[model samples]
Target: MHTLSNAPLRTVVWSTGGVGSIAIDAIARRPDLELAGVWVHSPEKVGRDAGELAGGEPLGVTATDDADALIALQPDCVVYAASGPDRDGGAVPDYLRLLAAGINVVSTSSTSLVYPPAYYSPDWRDQLQEAATSGLASFYASGIFPGFGSDQLALLLTTQSKKIDVITVTEIALNDHYPVADVMMDGMGFGRPLDFEPMLKTPGFIEMAWKAPIHLIADGLGVEVTEVRGTLDRRVTHRDIEVAFGTIPAGTCGAVRTRAAGVVNGREAVVVEHIIRMARDVGPDWPTSEFDATYRVDVSGDPDIHCAMNLGAAEGHGAGRAAMAATAMRVVNAVPYVVAAPAGLLSSLDMPNTLPRYAFE
Candidate 1:
């Protein structure tokens, strides 16, 4: 067992995009973590200070496009937050290489790795396991929805249930402000023709993307999921709406509703649902929250339970920046526990409770 020590853990920020930029900021600010090095994929980012890339003051640590050079720094942990929807295939090999080099990793790139064995092939699972064992490192994958919003928070809420019957976790977001063009336009079908099929509607894609959270909840409840199923639907915009990313023309795909359910016996006992909209009016009939970004949990049992969490900006941060910070902090906060954990692919169930490093003044 690894013991807590006075020396800060040497850490590397694997990418300087979206969540990766947030990780760099958090690591540089935290007193318990040392910003060792940064690995960047873009040559333009090469030689830039990690702090500048993260939109903060210079931290003296230069970002490198060379993966091998960052690995040579011998970082204790790597926060892998590379863009996943389009770059997942390459991200896996990067993770494997990092783990093999004795560097623990916490990532938001591959949601499947939240509970890897549930979605990954046995060969892939064994390879990751073997690599971790050989290098004495650990790898944990998580994000906002799959990490805390659905699996972890739902499980934590269920502890209050006298006799739990069903648990449903939902994420309702007005995604117009989110600035990922590929994910918004191509990946999710937003701003696309109504007849055009997005990747989310592809058969088995929803199940593959969400099975980890379903399995995680089921395992926590000590129930065997008989099967996993999913449904997808979309709504068109009635009028043109301008968003931070781009414009959504009238009659284009503007909102999406998807549900992935895990069946235990004959009932959909565990469920993860998403109601994502580019504009508020696009899906008036669908589920929504008062806040722009909200996570909700509804548990049906002897005494019914309902919980809603709103995520937004701090005093100086914008809503978009706060959301990204929350996502990055989820994995960043887990670093201490992950480093202290035994070498392996750890799920939420395996790790100890992770709290913020500097919550109180």
Candidate 2:
């Protein structure tokens, strides 16, 4: 394990998108963390100040498109927030590169990596483990759903139960405010035809994206998951609705509900369900929440436990920005623990409770 000193840990922001921008702001404002560098994928973002791109202020830290330069800086950690659904090809190499360069990584890019061994093949898992060992660095993957909503938060709530039967974690969110076009449209099938089969609906897709959370919960509770299953359904909009990404025409696909079920002993033991909508009225009959973005965990056992968490727009931020900020903070707050952890793939279960720093001030 790497020992961290009392001084601030040097850090780098790996992208400038929604979540990445929020990470930059959080790192710059925290007293225990120093923003060392900013990496951008676009040519237009190159040479721009990181502070300007993050919070409209100048921090004198310029953004660069050079990945090698940032790796050479040898920062204590990297907060990777790049967006790409197809993890097998897009973000895996990037993570391997950083870990091989001896930089500890905490990321929200790949959801399956939240509990890598759950869904990844032996070859891939061994490769990442080997990289971490070779470079003497730690790697952790997390986010709102796979990170906290399902695995961490849900498992925490289960501690009060006297007997365990089934655990369900749900994400009910209106995605209209979310501005990621590729994710909202191509990845999720929102704003597309009802008949169109999005990548999310493909066979084994939901199981792969959510298998980590299911496995994490099962492992934490001392149970084994026998099999994993998935189901997906969509709803159409009744009228045109304007969203942050674009307009969704009437009769188009506006909502999607997906479920990844972990069966144990011939019964559904742990389930992760996503209720995503582009309009509020699209899925009225489905599980609805008062908050724009909410997560609910229901435990069926001797001592039944139910908990719901609501996340919405702050005083000056939009709903989308609020969600991004929360997601970024989930990983950003884990930096210290990750930096101090042993050189290997770390999960929320492996680290202590990661709370916010300087949040009250």
> Candidate 2 on 1-361: residue-level lDDT in tens?
4788988999999889889999998898899999999999889999999999886699999999898999999999999888765655677687789888889999988778888669567677788889998989999888888779988889888879899788999998876777778888889998898888889987898888788999999889988898889999999999998998889999899889999999988999899999998767898999986667788999999799999988875322355566677899999999998999999998888989888889876
Q: Evaluated with lDDT, which candidate comes out highest?
A: 2
TM-score of each: 0.95, 0.96
Lowest-sum lDDT 10-residue window in model 1: 313-322
lDDT of 1 by residue, 58-106 (tens): 9999999888888888888999988845656878788789889998999
lDDT for each candidate structure: 0.85, 0.87
Predicted structure 1, TM vs. truth: 0.95
Number of the top TM-score candidate: 2
Once fitted onto the true fold, the runs of candidate 2 whose alpha carbons sit more than 4 angstroms away are 313-318
Please list the residue runs of candidate 1 whose C-alpha ends up more than 4 Å from where it truly belongs after superposition.
1-4, 313-318
